[model samples]
Target chain A: MSRSVTANLKTKYLVMTKKVIFIILALYTFSSWSYAGGGWPVPKGGFYFKLSEWWLISDRHYTDAGQIDPNITSGIFNTSIYTEYGLTNRLGLVVYFPFLSRAYVNNVVSGTTGDLLIAGDAINTIGDTDIGLKYSLTPQGSIKTAVTLTLGLPLGNSSGGSQQNLQTGDGEFNQMLSFDAGTSFSTKRVTFYTNVMMGVNNRTNDFSDEFRYGLEFGAGFLDRKIWIVGRLTGVESFKNGATAAQVNSTSIFANNSEYTSYGAELSYYLTSKIGFNVGYASAFRGELIFANPSYTVGVFLDFTK
Target chain B: MNIFSRAILWAIVWSFLSCIGDDIIDDRVDPVLRITNAIDTMEINTNYTFEALFLNHVGKEEVITLEWNTSDPDLMRIDPDGNATALAVGVVRIGVKGIAPSGEAVQDEVPCVIGNSTVNNLKERKAIVKTTSSYLLEGDAVLQEMEGGFLKLSLAENYKASTALPGLYVYLTNNPNTTAGAYEIGAVSVFSGAHDYELPSEVKLTDYDYLLYYCKPFNVKVGDGKFED
Candidate 1:
């Protein structure tokens, strides 16, 4: 009878183990379905196209002593369309086409107008196109980390007008290395996600090293179809090169200027694969940038295999 | 069969729990701090009103106390109610500090310029001149020439013209070595010979110290060898 009792205890333990495994599997399947319903970052084997108009108030400086004018405000209306095609479950290829880029400067000081200073109608031409590859380095259940390497080709109009500073492109070819890491979690009706990124720029001219950093938070409502997003990006550069004469003639006081912008975006998913987005952005304290707020509007198309 | 199966089940459960804990820790920090209508910069010797709105984690409105301060004591002064008064002519750093309900602090600073004074002495004058073919035939001049004929003048204490001319002319000297400089002056004959010349309605003396003169020769009639004044 003791032997029979031991056998029954073993059988009970086995049944409990099976129940635990079954429960885990059920939970995993349910979470996966819920993630699909929520519109977040693209999953593996997915493709997406985003067309956005990014407006920038460039507070770029030309000298280290800060002798040139620091309040140079210019508006750049950029229309960028990029597509990401997943090559595998962990790797993807991205191609960006900045088909239209128009920049304008107003309220310039005297002796820096017309041909002397960069002024006139907007110049809409192709800008530096970016080609890159993104690979997911760490893919836990709720957290993901990715690394990307991008090459900026000077295939756009860089020498169109007499104003050397008003070129449609930055002229030199560059390479940007970045790391993007993010995670998401959700319950029955709420969802949350956060991401951090860092970019290292390599260029020919000694145009100071640039540091770009941002944080993004998003939440969903209405059956996880509509979402609200907020972002804050800050850029700082160290002055390393001699002041260029071209930029100095236009404004007073020149030094490597730091820019910090905070803004919010609202997006609505029409279907699981298409959505619309709008946002307003402004620089807090920029010398050579616009004093007013800049606005943006765009659309996105997402797909998964 | 019992011990091995139970250990495997517990290990899987622990792994999942660890993963969830890591995610929570990573997303705990707030992503944004929203402050609206915050004043960044203002001119000195001028009064400005400042206000701001703070947003909480859930995008809800929250009450925040704003503290005002300036880098330069003699240059400017700011009060807690967002009142800024300029004291001197220079660049002053104005800072706005926001204290949230959770004791979080955020600050932003902007540069403000204090001018010496506003231009009040410069004046804009208009002169009219009319002429006809009969007057020309009779050798009568169209307009009488004044000592400073049709000259736009701004006379401030300790500021004087080096050389005085009767016709349209500009000063070669520049003033206000501190920061202020002459911007521009424009003149045009709107009504030709038969109409009067109207200058700009107002001009500030502090802004300008040069004179731009538009003078035409006086046309006096000499009939039958006698000059008519």
Candidate 2:
């Protein structure tokens, strides 16, 4: 194993013992940010596309101090398309677009009077989109490495509902630079791959810049037709941006959200090129973020296979 | 079903499940009968008409028939219409009782002394605001009557709150359990240190029994301060 892959394995083991905490931000944005790709860029003339739905319904959230506090039940759903196509021998193009996004808050009714204290509201719109270019740093090596530069486009409703607290986006354009390194190995029958990622997201509109990292491990079974993947991702805020007291907007998804989460996914290939996947993720610790599990279901077409 | 068809079915089910639902909250508060226009003292042979406000279980004010009485009817007699006459120089307790819409009995009483002149019972009230949730919120707050019938609510310098708490708002309310009928002061912009909010002339210093801190969007109570009697 290469030094970087070995180091990543050690780091992953250490983080597993420690508690994960921080905020999972936006609707569809951060959910896909850490799961973009591994170290290998798509091969020349290769293409991979996925149609997925992701949702989160929460009745509480972690306070700034990492303590859970009750909140009105709220939910967000995003139906998105993610695609990656190889442009050259070492370059690839990536796109993630959520064409349908819905965010809603439950109606608050008085238990004693059976009267509506606050009416529920919902908004339907397109969520933010991300376009990126990934370049392979080492096309021929035991340990593969790649770098990706993703541009975030603010396209969804930042302020929705009567109180302007329901949001589908952060309303700020951001640029993220990330690096990935991974290696694959086979143990008798099981094919295993491990990857590590690190990134820095520079955000505009007074939103805090964030440092992102993750570790992903996948093992294939049944003649490499079924794969089980486990992931650990985290985002740490720089906290240099404007606070709620300094900002004029009464946005409930305020800045400086941080969280560390763990997720598991099961992927089954019905054929050589067609597959389906289901995933579940939740935070063990968080601040200024919802305290609930998120679910994802998707079908993919892999021309690269 | 095929894997693709199953995935599609799951997505459809998730969409159906995402529909809005109702969240019932326990907002029941004790019904209260309060004398809105109260006096600390009344002059001998003076006539004054007292008014009382009845708040229901949810803290919404409702018009209800209140029975008025005086402790020493010989010294000061109050009629059923709340009309009072001080006949002698003495101290007596004026009481008003009412039943709420939920059939809960409530009453309030105040001590009145027959003196040289009738004095309005207006005084500054203070309370220590503390968080009822896990969020960091605490401070000293004072509500005082100003000239022109305005009320000035001032927070002490030691006040500090979690800036990450989004949509944090302040209000003056009789019930601290909910903000359904509370008078919204405004969104809270000052998270720490001292700040003051000027309430309109219509809001009296004694109008609200508690200062409320709520998250407007989440519709949850964050903190509250009960006025020290």
Candidate 3:
């Protein structure tokens, strides 16, 4: 209604989500532990394939000027494929790409004139892609441990749409390596498991690198036909990126963005080795990031022999 | 974990979300209008070029088009760029208004009387000065071309400056933000209040489009105004 409110809302809904797609996709694609790509590496000649779609919308943000109120509603929709194939009993190859990604903003009307003050916009393109390798540390154990290394490709459009606020990707290349450990306990009807992971991110092109961590719990439902999981993730950036105050122009994606988020997911297996995961995630606290919720759905195929 | 403990954990997580602040930006700033020369009244049959100041939404003063009007057109009349001519010996209100590209509006008014002629005055052209970037570099300086080739640039009393910023230098340039084509004018001695800058006749006001204040060492833009006819 007011100008400041409107400006803040516009940036939150439109601008914050522009580059945020990369991080959101990162979490949904690679940061899985408890409900991940079979934590310990698959057997030799085994494979796992997954397809995920994510939708994110926000009317609020944590900016350089602190938290902003809701005034604008911005959204992003992306669908990507994640695939893994075991090279040996202890090693595997991974590939991830959000081939179809779309970013958009809703129109804003003036209260006085009922006329459009800010017109709506939409842009569709490919999102950033990733490729990696995973290795198992133990052949067989009650407690499993593994490690992963991945490289990011700047395949998405960083400068797309009518305004700069309509971008679908972060324009930077990065690499990350992480350590993960998990364990499970069963009680006849359900098997509950916990996993923990920590990693270091390396970046280039004036963007800051980061340290990432995740902890999660998962259990089986309906005679092991379904799986339900809850996860918590943290991202701490090395505050060395650029920051500009103008809501429409400056790129906050390169700035020091930090967040702690929580999520819940349900995976229904229609048949052995075939399933779908549906989930919702939200950042309870963050800086230089959107303060909103994201929903995700994925269908996967598992080949175990 | 048991169902009761899992439920408790989720409730605790949801409660911690209260710490998340939701305010985005403070306000949509209103463009401002200031009169640098500070004149209240004029005599009949006399002509004066009114200098109305303006600042954009970012708190940075910038040049903009303005339309002027008078409450009593019979007593006094104002042109589009704020040029006023006293017609009758009566008090009236002169106002300036501007609308932004986004349809945001700003306006200001002042009181003046048209009485008897006081003195013979020279007819001079005037242009309003504006800051280039954001962060509180705002003021309206009036640049009046003298009878000779020399010109006088004066900062209005309402001018505001960025605090604690050093190495601020002023220049006349063909560009708005850069000093590549600038004619060095020297450091900014004052941030606010009325101040004057004497310009050389070699380069006419038409030589460039902007009067810029930049930090020499940091290459940061402090503020600036444009030279207009």
B72-188 per-residue lDDT for model 3 (tens digits):
999888899778889999888888888765567877777786777543232233445554444356777666667786877677887766433334567876444344446788766
**DockQ of candidate 1, scored on C-alphas against the true complex (2 decimals):** 0.01
lDDT tens string, model 2, B1-229?
9665676666656765788899999988888898878888999999999888888888888999899999999889999999999999999999999888788889999999998899986668899999999888899999988878788999999999878766789999987888888999999999999999999999976678899999887776889999876
| DockQ values, each candidate | 0.01, 0.62, 0.06
Off by over 4 Å in 1: A1-45, A56-74, A106-119, A245-257, B1-229
Every model's TM-score: 0.45, 0.92, 0.60
**Per-candidate iRMSD:** 27.7, 2.0, 13.5
Off-target runs (Cα >4 Å) in candidate 2 are A1-35, A252-254, B1-13
> What tens digits encode model 1's per-residue C-alpha lDDT throughout B1-229?
5432443343334322321000000111221232223333444567765454454332234567778788997888878876778777777777777765666676666565567543222133221112111111111112222234242332222221111111112221122110112232422212112222222433222122222221111011111111111
- Give one digit per residue, the lDDT tens place, for model 3 in A7-54: 111122232222100001136321121122335454568766666666
| Model 2 lDDT, residue A35, Cα | 32
Q: How much lDDT does candidate 1 score?
A: 0.41
* Cα lDDT for residue B93, candidate 3: 83
> Candidate 1: TM-score?
0.45
Query: Model 3, which residues run further than 4 Å from truth?
Result: A1-38, A245-254, B1-38, B41-109, B113-229
lDDT of each: 0.41, 0.76, 0.59
Best-performing candidate as measured by DockQ: 2
In model 2, what is chain B's TM-score?
0.91
